[model samples]
Each structure stands twice: as C-alpha cells, then as structure tokens.
Target: MGSPSDPARHLLDLARSRPPTLGDGRLVCIDGPAGSGKTTLAASLAALAGAPVVHMDDLYDGWDGLPRVTDQLDGLLLPLTEGAAGSYRRYDWVLQEYVEAVTVAPAPLLVLEGVGAGSLAHAARCTVLAWVEAPDALRLQRGLTRDGPQVEQHWRRWMRAEAEHFADQRTRDRADVIVDGTAAAPPRSPGRVT
Candidate 1:
C-alpha cells in the first residue's frame, strides 16, 4: 500500500475497507467548494480505483442549481442502492437546460464529485466522504481562469450559494478526510480518518 498521506491511496483503502453502501458498489464522494480541486481529486481516485465518476456538475440544473442537487442525487443514487443501474439527465451549460440521460451501472466503486456531492441526504450511503478546500481568493481565480471572465458574476453568485450550502451541510465537520486543495503534493495528515 502507498503512504496514507496520498489522497488517492488513502481514499481507495478507505473505500475497500468499508462495506458497500450503494448496493454492491462503494460510493466515494469527493465534495468541496467550486474550483477547490474536487474534480482533480475525483479523477485521481477514479483512475486509481478503476471507478466511474458521476460529476454533480452534470446533474445541476444551471447557475442556481446547487440547492436542488440533493434531489438529483437521490434520483441517481437510490436506484443504485437497490442493486439496479442508476441514471440522470445531464445539464447542458451551453443550452442552459437538461438534455440527455446518462446511465450508471452499479460497480465495485463509483466516484461522485462536485459541490453538493456530499450533502446530508446521502451521507449515510457514502463509503468515503472527502472534503477538499482552498482559500476563497485562489478558488475564485481558478474559476475565472477555467470559466473565463464573462462568467465572473455567475461565479460570484455560485461561490455565495456554495458557501451557504456547505455551512448548512456542515460538510467539513462530517468528512472522513479533509484535503488541502492548494497543496503542491498529495495531502499529508488528512483529518478524521487518519
């Protein structure tokens, strides 16, 4: 096994150590504020575990979709918990609406990644809930760089919305692991589980 400080290794070990919570599959939720590297972490963990990732970005309705994502997750995860394949309609950002449906077949491991991916509604079913975070300034900068300055207003609103959601969810406090998004190396001493 790799060092426990390696987030991907730590998460994979955590997932394998736990009983499957999403039917025969284990769910690893990589959740955090926008631009905080949740996607990066999810990709790394998915690669390490050979898991399929369901991005919450695809489930969100639009700019104001954060609050409604829990319901969307319920729609996606409930079927999986019943040992059936799950699916969700992917939202097209350019079209500003939901379009095609994507099916997720139950597997040994699944990575759920995004802002509301660790909501209280499905916390009980998460085999590993990891919270990644960076400073607000850095996160805002990252968002603008990726999304462009044209969406700055949208980013601002989203940051505010996510802040409120995280507080309400108490996500960090409940995390099995807490990763520093700005760290140059894999996180060391991730909280709680370590």
Candidate 2:
C-alpha cells in the first residue's frame, strides 16, 4: 500500500505499465458547478489516463430534460464498461437540435465530465469520482464571460437546474476526491485504490 497523496502519479504509472494490478477498466467522473473548469481538468485527466473524454453537455436535448439526459448516459455507460464501441448524438445549441454523432471507443479509462457527471446513478460504473468546485461568485463570473448575451437566459436556467440537481444528487458527498480551483495546479490524492 502507499500513502494517500499521489493519485495522478499513480494513475500515470498504471497507464504506462499495462498490468492487471490497475484492476478492471476505469471510469473517471469529473463533476462541478458551471464554469468551474471541469472541462479543462477532464482533458488533463484524460491525457494522464491515456483515454478520451465524453462530454455530458453534448447529450442534452436543450436547456432542460434531465430524464432524457440520463437516458443518454445509460446508452453510453453500458458499452463503455463492456468494452464495445459506441456512438451518441450531440445536441447543437446553435442549430437548436441534435447536430452530429460522435463515436467512443473503449479505452483503458473513460473520463465522463460536466455538471451532474458524478451523480449516484453513475456510481456503479465510476472507479474514480472527483468534484471540482469553485466559489459561486467565481463560477458566476466565469459563466458570464463564457456564455455572452446570446446564452444569458439559457445559462440562468441551467444554473438553477444545477443548484437543484446538486442538492438532490449530493455528488460532493460521494466524491473520492475534492478539488478546489484556486490552486495553481490541481491537488492530487496519493493512490488510494478504492
């Protein structure tokens, strides 16, 4: 066993050595409030795991529809665990509809990232779950900077929905790791093999 402060290093070691010690395939779920840099962190983690990321925002029908979004998650999760190739359609906000399809190939690790990414409904498939949080004020400012006037209404609605979802889901409580975004670099856990 090892100490509890080097998760990213351990994950990198696992990826470099193709050994069963890493256990079954892994799924890393990165969840956070809007504009918390979830996407940036997810991309870094994917690079570390030598895998690809599946963005949850791409699956939604519109600004609303949590049930349908869950359905989309179900469609992707099974095949990902079974090591089968799968594809999902991405909703295009600009086009006001689902615009195109994206294929996901099974990898040693799969990173699922976005708001609601770490809900308990997904716990079974997730090997490592992380919550990336920032001060609400920081998040709101970032949201405004990113969304612009065109998405102001949509962003507001999404924010309220996220607050409710996080209240019910309590994803932060179940997270294996909690990350605050103010650090120059993300803090890492020393390989705790849950």
Candidate 3:
C-alpha cells in the first residue's frame, strides 16, 4: 500500500469513491498555471489509475487560443458524455495550424491536464478537480528554461492570459485538491519505482 500522504494515491482513492460524472467514466481534471507541475501530477495519477490523458496543449489552436478552448473542449468531451468516441482537431505548433483529429474512446477513467482543463462548463462533469501551483518567479523560470529565452515575450503574454482565465474561472477556489508544485517529494526507498 502507498503511504497515506501520497498525493497520487489520495487522488486515486477519491476518484474511486466518487460516482462517475462523465458517462460511465471518471474525469480527473488537472489545471493550473504553466510550469506549475500539473503535467507531472497528471502523469502520476494516470499511471496509477491506468488512465489515458488528453493534454489541453493539444486542444489549443495557438498561444492566444486559451480564450477559445471551451469550444474545443466541447468537441472532445460532449461525445464522451454520451458514451461515444470523442475527437478533437490537434493544433500543430510547428505548422501553426490544426492537423488531424484525435479520437478518445470512452473509458473507466480519463485525465485532462493543462490550463483550462477545469473550465466552468466542464466542472460538473469532473470527478475531481486538482489545482497545482508554484511561485510566480519559479514558474516563470521553469517556463523560460524549458521553452528557451527566445520565447520570453510569449511566456509573459501567456502568463497574463492564464492569470486572467484563472481569475475569471475561479479555478483555484473551486479546486477539490490544491497541490504545492514546489513541494519536495518524499524520499523513496531504493529500487522503488515511482
């Protein structure tokens, strides 16, 4: 058994205890600012639950696409709610255009991770909403390091956009669980797989 304080374990337990809100499946929505470790937490939860994750990044049309994500999410999630396969046009960052459609079949569990994953329109359908966060400076540093300094302007713009979205959505206030993205992980025993 995992430790009582293990966030992934706790999240899994909560999900299992809840009634399915998305068709016959539970939807775990992980939303937070960029570089806030939302992706890492989603990966951990998905691995533990043997769930497939749909990244919001793939649903976004572009850097300025955050404001328009509800329509994209509707395309992806509405079908799933009816026990049908859902599909969304993936935005190709390099091509700067939407590419082929990605289909997601209904399952026992599905993880939606990234900004706008827990928008108001979809909140009622989420089994659990988790908000992960780190300090602004740390998040900015991480973003710059991963995306390169050349995209600093883009990062700044994105930061403002996400802040506005989060504020408008009251995402943090509605979160069922709030994780400290900067928290140090507990020490693991030798040879233990995370």
State the local distance difference test value for candidate 1: 0.88
Where does candidate 1 clash, by residue pair? Answer: none
The candidate maximizing lDDT is 1
lDDT, candidate 1, 1-194, per-residue tens:
45656888988987898899999999999889999999998999999989999999999999999988877897789999999988898999999999998999999999999998988999878988999999899999999999899999999999999989989988887788888898665654344421
Task: Report the lDDT tens digits of candidate 3 across residue range 1-194.
Answer: 34545767767777788899999999989899999998888899899999999999998888999999999899889999999998888999889899899999999999999999989998878888878888899999999998799988988999999999999998888887777787665312222011
lDDT of 1 at 76: 89
Summed backbone clashes in each candidate are: 0, 6, 0
41-139, model 2: which lDDT tens digit per residue?
777667766778888889888888554677777677767666677678899977879888788877777778888777667667777677778887788
In candidate 1, how many Å is residue 62 off? 0.6
- CA lDDT, every prediction? 0.88, 0.70, 0.86
C-alpha lDDT (0 to 100) for residue 67 of candidate 2: 46
Off by over 4 Å in 2: 1-24, 184-194
Report the C-alpha displacement of residue 74, candidate 1, in angstroms: 1.4
Model 2 worst lDDT window (10 residues) = 14-23
TM-score-best of 1 and 3: 1
